[model samples]
Target chain A: MLKKSGTTLIEIMIALFVLASAMIPIASIMGYGGRATSKDARRILAMQLLDKTLRQMLQADYDEIPIGKNIQNGFEGIALGDVTAGQDKGFSFNISLDSEYVNPVKFKYRGVGVNRPTFKADSPVGDDFLPEETISLNDVVIKLTVTVTWNEQQNLPVSVSAMTYRADFQRRTG
Target chain B: MHYLDAKRSGMALIIVLTLATGILILGISYINTIRKQSGRNTIELGAIQADLLAEGLTQIAMLKFKEIPGPLYYAYIAHVKGNTSQPYSVYHGDAILGGKLDSPFNAEFRTTFQLLSSKMYQDMNVKITVEVEVSRPDGEKYQRLIERTVSGSRRPAF
Candidate 1:
């Protein structure tokens, strides 16, 4: 009793409190880790899906290429079970040539509010950027960007994307 | 008795601090994970939209191609929408190898595609390109080029 030794109940409680406090943060981090894992997995899956679609389109004939909002609606007319409409992960595929580069904005259906911004064929806004009329699309260079998003705060929603490009295939002409 | 009281109080403080730190770390981690998930979701949806756009461009081109009555085709422009905010720009080119109108937009991203093929691949092939741009509400811009070159042949009779 004279010599102070062994942890007092008070000290034990204190230690426990500290440990408990520490655990809170750890738990939060763990929660975050779980979500991160989900994102990573989804990213990978999204990439695989995009690649599959691109490859299929590449191999298929023009008519066979599924067009317009149909792909977004899904392989079928409706969305997959458990997958909501807005929740669908979509892909965009584009094929171009030298002529299209001349006026990219006008060439692409999405770009609005301008007639034609004539940039030289070699400048960053011109012809030399994508491989010059490659032997084929493999020579052409195809790009893909996969994005997955979810709402965390308000409706602001956060999105993560992975992008890749396929070297244009050499054009096979008789 | 006073000394003992002080020690216990000190311990409590330490415990509280430690717990706070733990919670902070966890909260941060969770936020990060959530942010990442949100990003991925955006990527997936965007990709799917792009795929449809590419296919649409080709189908439309085919229809336009058929309308033209000759083989030495003229450039026909294909203007499709992208992110939703922008207007529908014009892409005027040959009906066959659909050439571009030659604009002064960012090449890698802002540029659009047109077919320049001389003839169909094996009389059944169809080739078209759709331009996809990845732009964030936060002001970051990326570009995606989707090209579909498909070969077609006569269907077999059952």
Candidate 2:
């Protein structure tokens, strides 16, 4: 009876060994999946923050907008201290503006005008190719770039950047 | 005694097989869940990209309007042709202008403008609508629409 029981115990041990061998790879795969999902979530959040900042900059008055780095926080409504209280809690962003004044006449005259063969009164060809009206006021084109940075699951740094241009033009009445 | 030993070994084998199969199924389910989640993320990203592209295109259209001499004439022509209600394809290509998303995706933009009645003879009310569509590498599509009314003094050239 003692010999029989020993043989049964050995069989159970072998079965457990096979089961454990299969589990390690499965567990690792799950871990990898978890990490990937977390990373994607953080990336989406960063993109949202960047988009918000860009829109705010575009809506602001051209004269009111400030130039330089770290002028506006990406999170407008959220408090900075609250966002930075804990580790990996939130994100930070910086907005920078580059402005250049363009002469409408110089810009227009430089273009080589090519009349489209299929031009119709109602259907115009590409606007880029069309002759633009000369603006009385010099055009101030502002390029705004917003960069957002955040920490991932393992404190891995991730960043997203977006850029847009705002043209400062107002109609002049005689 | 031999038969009893054989029966005990058979039961152990069955238990192991069951445990292994269960683990395999669990792993597969987890993988499927992850795949679905990843797809969702891709769709979300595509939507956001489309929105940004639409916004950028609208700004471009506005800039173009400002540059053109006869903004009201163009708006009136578009309205007369009934194109203002429908989207008119302006640009279609894979160019990443001033926006995020480093990956080059297919982009198409359509614009239309309508002329609004104004009390001031010099001032013209033009409502421009822009639509942008972006396609992801995975064959997913997203679209966005934006409209803005721009009122400005008409140039004499118009």
Candidate 3:
């Protein structure tokens, strides 16, 4: 008579092992994908924040632009929109300005000058001709930098920055 | 009995191999898709940066014109009149192009200036073209051109 034989314990265990090994990589990939999506979302928000802040800085009057570095925490609610219950949360931004001189060649010949008010006789009389090769206060090049920083899930610090130059054009008038 | 047992084990081995191969393919495909998506994001970010930087450079060019209106006007006029030897005749070369600005990624800029008009009783308009090229995080390069025209509020006295 013919008899049916059941699979042994070793065969079942080997099959399970093979399946689990294959699944391990898939599970890890899924985890990595989730984290990557979160990071990308945060990066998008950071880029938007940076763009807005940089536009504001560029639009401001050159003289009125705050010089040196300034940092703002909870910048999202302040710069972006209102937060829940007046809570300041999310990324921080740092803006800085560094100025340098852009020397323009001075001409010996003087053109129209601003009329000066009469001074007291005690004051020393300055030269009628403007000093040659003198740089004006407006002849300056300013480097403006805006950076946004945030901490990721593992408390991993992530930051991005954008910088551009702002020359003191002295173009704006009262 | 031995033949039957061997046949059953062979069937089990085939099933396991098929399952493993299917899963391995799926994993590789998923990883490739993710990599492509990440690369696209990097390109998008690089393009945005290049455009913004170009805009900023345009503004800087406008400001530079405003700051040195007299010299720039003189230079333009000298160029038109074929007087290259005069002081402030040159458009000051690329001195206005502030070179590379600091950023998380690499960026470079090139600028060109055109004196649009110098007619009588009209505003002197200067057209500035700013070309900003940025290298993406994914080893790709992006370029953007921003053009702006700024008019002098008042004619510069040269």
| Candidate 2 per-residue lDDT over residues A101-173, each given as its tens digit | 3343122211212355655544543442344323343445555655666666566666655555555543332
User: Distance (Å) between predicted and true CA of B8, model 1?
Assistant: 14
Highest TM-score among the candidates is held by which one? 3
- The runs of at least 3 residues in candidate 2 whose Cα sits more than 4 Å from the true structure, single-residue gaps closed, are A66-138, A151-157, A169-174, B1-8, B60-71, B74-106, B116-124, B137-139, B149-158
User: What would the TM-scores of all predictions be?
Assistant: 0.40, 0.64, 0.70
Q: Identify the leading candidate in terms of lDDT.
A: 3
Kindly give the stretch of ten consecutive residues in candidate 3 chain B with the minimal lDDT sum: B83-92
Give model 1's TM-score for chain A to 2 decimal places.
0.44
Task: Tell me the spans in candidate 1 whose CA falls farther than 4 Å from its real position.
Answer: A1-3, A6-9, A28-174, B1-27, B69-127, B134-142, B149-158
- How do these models rank on TM-score, best leading? 3, 2, 1
Per-residue lDDT over B1-158 for candidate 2, one digit per residue giving the tens place of the 0 to 100 score: 77866666658867887888898888888888888887886677667666765665566556655655354454344445665511122211112222234434576666665567653336667677767777777887787888889877656863
Lowest lDDT block of 10, candidate 1 chain A: A96-105
Candidate 3 lDDT by residue in tens digits, B5-98: 6666656767997988988888788878877776776677677678777876676666656655554554454445554423332333444463
Instruction: Residues A1-174, candidate 3: write the lDDT tens digits.
Output: 233334455666788888888888889988888877767776767667666677666666666554555434323223422222112445443333333333552212222122445422122123221332323344455666666666677777776667666665554554
lDDT per residue for candidate 1 within A1-174, as digits (tens), equals 423434455566777767776776677667667766654554455445444544454444332223222123223221211231213543222221111111211112212112235522111222212221211111132333333344432444544333333322223223
